[model samples]
Target: MAGTEIFGIEEIKALTDVIERKMIHRYGSHSVRNGIYRVEEFEEKAKKITGSKHALALTNGTAALITALKGLGVGPGDEVITSPFTFIATIEAIVACGAVPVLGEIDETLGLDPVSAEKLITKKTKALVPVHMFGAAADLDPFMEISIIYGIPVVEDACEVVGGTYKGRYLGSIGKCGTWSFDPNKTLTVGEGGLILTDDEDLYFKMDCYHDHGHIHSKAHDRGEEGKFGLGVNYRLSELQGALGIVALDKMDATLEKIRKTKKRIINSVKDTGIKVRPMHDPEGDTASHLIFMLPSPEAAVNFSRAAGEAGTGFSIISQNTWHYAKHWKALEEMGEKDIFGTKAPSYAAETMAATEAMLSRAVMTGLNINMSDGEIERIIRSVKCGAKASL
Candidate 1:
């Protein structure tokens, strides 16, 4: 919802200017290849913003995840532990890398439970991918400790929590490597783009090469020049997308501030509704992009959601959403005894996430967008109040 609409008129002008510059300079479509200025500029800005040593722009968030996994050497026989309550992209990335995805239980935070993740670890556990769902930071300290103890890398899926911070450190910067999405509904949008951020140079280079057909290019050996090629695929972001991303990134702070203020107001509005409502995770020291609350029970959640929808202020029931909910993933059902890697697939399905289900069954959520007018916010508050009263 944050990036659902155009935020500034300058962004359109910037996009047009970049397109004209590309055509005038005869750059063709070599956004990443010809060293188009905006691509590198966006990467540098991203690195600075995320406090990472290196950042790479890619095609989309899913590609970012796959590239991060490939860069970490997670494949075939390796097992990647992640939350079952996240978007399918989290598990799909592990599967794309030929790694067995071990679904871990979530705590009250609605993120991967560090205790459950520790229990899922084995000799084959190569990585832990924790999704920072709905702009809320997961319990990163324990995950960091687990990473140190097991020598396993942590790749954070911070697609929905770009500007959020845990404690003092940024969410994405806390892990070994992290990814952010710039889709239509993210904090920032370049239509369809993704970013990989890391402090590890070796891993960053690997991911860079992996996303760009394995060609390790330099100033001396530019696009057409001789360079060593490794195993990779095409995952480059276009020049137009890079330009849009630059503009979007520039406005990200203001946009997040507005959404956070509006979210606080909405939270305050529902405070005394005599309904049990609590945030899925602690919101202290974080920029919230969504308003997610847990109701008293599953029936209350359903009834509230229905009443809200009728009042024209619908809230998404996390467990019932096909995209974010884990139970609807058809790919997991297709996993047989053994994959192409000869490693047995982890016995993980919707039923395995007992805690996640129990939490989501009573959860009601709505996206917080900066584009929402004050009238819209007021209407949403009124609808929510009405829904709570009707359900009670």
Candidate 2:
């Protein structure tokens, strides 16, 4: 079964039409050189959708993360605490800024455990990155509390769950800053792009410069005028991506509804299968991007995954050793001593986060694509039943 699908030809036609218009208008400049009309529109729409005061488009989710970190002034000798159960990009962003990545345990939500994260905070701790993992909102309340108590900034990595909410507030809008990925695999696809959202004008300006080669663009500093440039890199999104993003944003609400319904059907179908399913942190709030369950044991998880594969269910068993899992980061070995700020990278491989490892080892997950047909959903439900019967 296809795991993820892109928008239809209508979206393609819209993007093409926008590109054609830009071509006709002699819009030769990229985002940095000159403001692309579509890029500006997309940013405006993104801010509205995400409920942020400012939204800056970037080349990819990784760029968004790095830019957010830089904007928060995270750097050498700073320790950023994050869950080990998230995508590698979360840790990579922290390390990219010459900061230490402190691994935190995850609760049933598969997000950073707030208590553990609070314990990890030290004088050197500069930020807290809580990933809204697999389309579910992390428990942001406690994290937000921790942030307030410690004076650390929280950067919500809402890459997977763009429209997901926690207690009625959008996932990306609760933290000091939030990021979303528009990669092909995500709910909202622009082929390849990302968004950084923030309410703080100063941080917004900082990230704006960070993503656009350090050039601060404002009313005082127009395109051609000299501005207060800083150390940064080229992470600007193209007009083509911006056009696609606009179309994707338009389709997000309906697509998310379909995904939620499909996820509900899949989850309800497996309710009597004796498998231990981890409930969403908030049923009404989560944006059901993936269906996740846990087996009785790691061995059972392996067996179930193998059986699911044989049954063509397309379910993956996430384990501690998975590349994205935190225990496997081996930060020093992976990042080496390449430092932009001449700081020694902390040894992450030595610290084993037992809770995160235990939680993920027996977990089975599958992507919930909006394009999945009813027949495919039924097939997955049947496959899960068959796999559980055979393996367990």
Using TM-score, give the best candidate's number: 1
lDDT of 1 by residue, 179-295 (tens): 988988787888899988899989988998888778785765447764755879989887788888889888877877887888888889888987665544457645677677777
Whole-model lDDT, candidate 2?
Answer: 0.79
Per-residue lDDT of model 2, residues 226-264, tens digit only: 475687898978777887778878887887788888888
Q: What is the total number of backbone clashes in candidate 1?
A: 0
Worst 10 residues of 2 by lDDT: 23-32
RMSD of each: 2.6, 3.3
The lDDT values for all models are 0.81, 0.79
Model 1, residue 149: C-alpha shift (Å): 0.8
Clash counts for the predictions, in order:
0, 1
Error of 1 at 77 (Å): 0.6
